[model samples]
Target chain A: MTRLAGRIGRFAWEIALPIVVLSYWWLATADGDNPFFPPASRVLEAFWSNWFDERFVSDFLPSMARLGASYLLAVGIGVGAGLLLRLWRPLGEIVEPLISFLRSIPSAALLPFAVLLFGIGTNMQVFLITFVCVWPILLNTMDGVADTDPTMLDTARAFRIGHRRRLTRVVLMAAAPRIASGMRVSLSVAVVVMLISEMFASTNGIGYVTIQAQRTFAFADMWSGILMLGLLGYLLNLLFVRAERLVLSWYYASKGR
Target chain B: MAPLLSVEGIGKIYGEGRSAYRAIDSVTFDVNESEIVTVVGPSGCGKTTLLKCISGLLPPTDGRSVLNGIPVTEPPEGLGIVFQDYSRSLYPWMSVAHNVAFPLAGKGIPRNEINDRVERTLAAVGLRGQQRKKPFQLSGGMQQRVAIARALAYQPKVLLMDEPFASVDAQTRAELEDTVVALRAEFNVTVLFITHDIDEAVYMADRIVVLTPPPTTVSEIVEVSLPFPRDQIGTKELAEFVKLRSHVYRAVKNRWDDRQPGQ
Candidate 1:
């Protein structure tokens, strides 16, 4: 019974902020004077109506599909590039400046160029999302690989372990915690880029629904779409954190001690 | 029979021209098959440089080191090394068993044979039940034992150690010293152990080679005539052990004086 109460206390601690925010929104927007702010009940009603509509399914699924595709692509290409940069010093030196310059350019600013290049299809959305997400993963992975302990490398050498096996067994295993951190950062970036790309050019996606509702003066629907996007982002982040905890339990335990 | 390993007029100089620093100057030593040879010296006297040259980890500037009649061009096969820092010497990600099994993986040993050898070697080091524990999980002494197990599992003809117990507590160091003595007796493997501690050198070595300071050379070689199955208290209290320890201590002190700035 004590353990159960402790768990409930922990649950309350986690949800406290969200509950307070919801309560404030209900209280503040009850008189409906503000054009920008909708009451919690009206937003909930709008959410239920749109959530069950068949047309809304098409937009939401396509946006999620695009996010998945872009995130996977970014991870694959970014990790591959990171490995290349780490293994080859001269190549890394040559490309590092260019990669830094590219990363400095705001990702949202690339939407216009992305639309011109990919012509406002699913491809454009994916390209933009990949562009925004790849930098964090690539930089983090390279840093991770570079920071792998030299002593461990020497240990591998003393044992006569070959280069390929050494890299796989020692270097990568040592770099895992850093790489997980990078992936978590990239996941949030992927979601942000997904919505931004849809807002800028896409005909189908949650962003498009939001844009349509705003243009049509459907204030409650617009608020509902915004709330859904925020919820989706929060859920994605939570999922990444959970996965990181599961996969890197050893790293966490070792670091904690 | 010829010595199991030989080093002839080995010299190592770091850098070149005006900046040149001579570490070992024409030093020579050899280890007979199944013999334990310890090199003792004061700090900065190039005893470690000599061991590095012999182990083929670093090439001597002007001389050759041969193992089994072949000149060592790289870290030669059938030779293993245990460094002082146990934290740096073992891969943290690998289990103790895997760390022990590491060196043998290249010899094309069957998987079962590798497991058998790792288990046997860990048992020899008194770490049998801790196979799955990572190196970081173990105590410093236990980690060093894992290092010893790794070197032993390699089944090397020659093992080189660089002040392997300098960092451990006195009690743990004594225990590890006994473990080495027992291992040397069981395996009959040649050892080229390097240390700055004269007492440790005298206690563990069959023959202790004392080195002179920088631009170092062999100053003396003291044969330990003490009997085997040695205990720390009993062996250290022996009259001969005390005499030899003092002799090594003096030799190393003289070298330090010789390498003094004005000398």
Candidate 2:
């Protein structure tokens, strides 16, 4: 009983500030006289009704699917290209300037161009997110692969471990921590770019719904859309953090020592 | 009879044209089958370059190293190396057991046999029950033992050690030296070990090859006929050990002293 109470106390401690602010919001806006701002309870009620019934299926799920697909594609191609460039130095040197130029162009500026190229749908959304997020992943993986200890390479060579085996076992494993950090940065980029593309050109997705709510002056519904986006970002980050812990446990364990 | 390994006129030149620097210069030697040969020299005397050439990690600009009657243009199948920096050489991400088992991954060996060999090799290095521990979790000496176990697990025809005990403290170094001696006898593997320490050279070698200072070549090769099953205390106490130690020490010192002005 004491342990359960202690656990609850700890949980409450974590949420204390947020709870206070939320209570303040509810009380201050209870009169409902404000034009733009709704009471916290009304926003929550709007969120429960709209998201649970229809908007979640149409807007939220499609947005999340785009995010997942784009992020996974970026990781796959980024890691592959990074390893290739690391192994083949001349190619990296030649392509690096072009990569820099491409990454430097603000992704928002490229949305209309992407829309023309792929047309507005999941394709345009995935293309935009992947294009922007790939840079961090590729560059980080390249740096990580290049920085593998020369002595370890020599050890692998000396042991007669073949090129393929050595690359996978020695180089890839050595670079995993850096690659994982790169992926985290890419994840946020993926989420933001997905939202941006959907807002600019798409007929569906959470961003489109949020904009639609704002245009209609359904302020509580707008708040709910904002709430869903925040939840999506937070939940994705939570999942990524947990996965990273498992994949790079060896790296963290050694660092802890 | 042909030597188990022959290093013939090996030389390594870095850079090009005016900036070309000769790291090794026509160094030559041979290791008999199952013989333990140590190369001792002053620091920066290209001892590592010579070892790298022998192991085929670095291609010599001239000449070649032949192992088991085959030219070592690349890392030969039956050769193993234990590098000096155990921290960098052993994969920190791999457990002690996996690191030992790595070299045999695609050698058509069964998984059970590979595990058996890993277990036996880990036991040989006195790390028997600690197979699951990662390299960083072990002490410096124990990490080196894992490296040695990795080399031993391969059952190489010759083992090349590049100052493998330099990082460890005196007690661990002494213990590791004994382990090498025992492993050498038990495996009957030829060894080409390099160190800057004359005492280490004298202690471990059946014959010691002393190389000159930078742009190095063999200055002398002194034979050590100390009997087998040598201990840290018992072996060093012998007059023969002392004599060989001083001889190699004087040779290394003289080569460094004899370097010309601006060299």
Candidate 3:
């Protein structure tokens, strides 16, 4: 009984701040005089109804598919380009200025150009999200690959490990920690950019639904959409953290020593 | 017969124009087949530069190194190197057996052959049961054993060791020295060992190629005809060992000191 009580106490510690804020919100909004900010109970009720229905299929699922495809593309291009640039310094020197210049254009500004090129729907969304999020991933992987210990390289060469095998087996493994960290940063960026691009030009996604709810004066629906977006971001980041722990356990284990 | 490995007038000059530095003026030496030759020099004496050129990791500014009749323009396929930094040289991300098997696996050797070599070399280095542990998880000496095992797994024509035992403790260093001495006999591998430790150079080598301070070249080649089965205490106590140790010591230092301290 005491052990169960201790476990409950630890659980309560995590939820304490959320409970306090929620309670304050519920009490303050109980009068229902405000249309812009709905009562907490109504918003929670809408959260269930708005999401656990057809919009879940139409709105949430597409957002997820886009997020998955775009993030994968970003990682693939970022790591591949990063490795290429690191292996060839002269190429990096030639291309880096152009990369920096491209990175500086506010992704919002890049969207219209992208929309004209790819013409709305999945391609545009994937294109915009990947463009915005890939820089951090690329830059981090490049730095990590460049930072590999020279002694390790010499060891590989001395042992007659071929260049391709050396890069894949040795160089890439050494740079994995940094690559993972970059992916972590870019995960959040990818989620945010996905929403923004959806809002700007998407026909149907969580961002489009949320913005539509506000425009149509369905404030409770808007609150529910916001809640679901938060949950989606939280879930993705959680999954990524778990994956990072599994893949880079050695990097962390050696660190603890 | 021609020497199995030859460092033919190897010279290296860093940079060009005003900032040019002569790291190795001219270093020439040879190792007969299955012989252990120690290249002993002081710190900052282009010891590493000389080895890199010989291994073909670094191009000599003038002349070339020949491994069997082939000039070494790239890391020769038949040579293995155990670097000085044991921790850095053994991939920290790999398990003990995996690090040993890396070169063979990289070469697309059959899995069974790689596994056999990995098992044998790990046992040869006294790391028989610790194959699953990562390099960083092991002691400094054990990490070096993984490196040595990695080199030996390949069955190279010549092994290049660069002050490989420098970082371990004295007890561990002594044990590793014995391990190398035994492994050399067991594997019959020619060794081009580089170190600054005079006693080690004398103890481990069949011939000590002592080098001048900087802008370095071979100062002398002192033959150590000490009988096989040399132990640390027993061999160091011998009169011939003492005389040859001091003789090579003077060649490295360019003068004599009676104290005979460890460099």
Candidate order (DockQ):
2, 3, 1
> What tens-digit string does per-residue lDDT give for candidate 3 at A87-113?
899999999999999878787888899
TM-score for candidate 2: 0.96
TM-scores for all candidates?
Answer: 0.91, 0.96, 0.94
Q: Which 10-residue window in model 2 chain B sums to the lowest lDDT?
A: B254-263
Q: Largest DockQ belongs to which candidate?
A: 2
lDDT tens per residue, model 2, B1-263? 99999999999999999999998888899999989999999999998888998889999999999988899899998898999999999998888999999999998889999998899889988998999998999999999999999998898999999999998998999899889988988888888899988888888889999999879889998999998888788999999999888888888887798895665
Better of 1 and 2 by TM-score: 2
Q: Provide all candidates' interface root-mean-square deviations.
A: 2.0, 0.9, 1.0
Which candidate's lDDT is highest? 2
TM-score of chain A of each: 0.91, 0.93, 0.93
Clashing pairs in 2: none
What tens-digit string does per-residue lDDT give for candidate 2 at A40-145?
A: 8899999999788887788878988999999999999899999999899999999999999998989999999998999989898899999999999999999999
> DockQ, per-model, please?
0.44, 0.82, 0.77
Candidate 3 to truth, TM? 0.94
lDDT, candidate 3, at A73 = 94
RMSD of each: 2.9, 2.8, 3.4
